[model samples]
Target: MTMILGFPLAPIRGVIKLGELLQEQVERELRDPAAVRRRLEEIEQARAAGRISAEEEAEAVNRVLRGMQT
Candidate 1:
């Protein structure tokens, strides 16, 4: 006999699995060295273009460099 009680939970389980996969992908990118360097370059360009203040650039550079260290 098939149980109907478990059917409703199937979509919930699939959503949870999808969320886990997304988290794993995000973590992998965060640890990538090239990704960190690219972010630093972007910050520099923004600063040069006056899109960000000098203080914001310094803060962003520090955050990106720290991410590289870890």
Candidate 2:
């Protein structure tokens, strides 16, 4: 059995692999302009619906827009 520091390594490796895959998918979605726009809209809708505070909405908007720039 694979081991690392006396702990099984297989489960650890699987967790790491899953994290990497999740990061890749998130990055891919963030790179898309439409995804950014959709997020912005969602943020605004949340604000309008009183689900999010103005500051929260602004921060989310800024983050989404910033991601689009990169």
User: Which candidate leads in TM-score?
Assistant: 1
TM-score of 2: 0.59
Q: Which ten residues in a row have the lowest lDDT in candidate 1?
A: 1-10
Which tens-of-lDDT digit does each residue in 1-70 have in candidate 1? 2458888888999999999999888878887978987898999999999999999999999987776566
TM-score of each: 0.76, 0.59
**Native-vs-model 1 lDDT?**
0.87
| Steric collisions counted per model | 0, 0
lDDT of the candidates, in the order given? 0.87, 0.85
| Candidate 2 global lDDT | 0.85
After TM-score superposition, what is the CA distance of residue 68 in candidate 1 from its true location, in Å?
5.5
Best by lDDT: 1
Tens-digit lDDT track for model 2 on 1-70? 3345647666887999999999989888988878887888899899999999999998998888787666
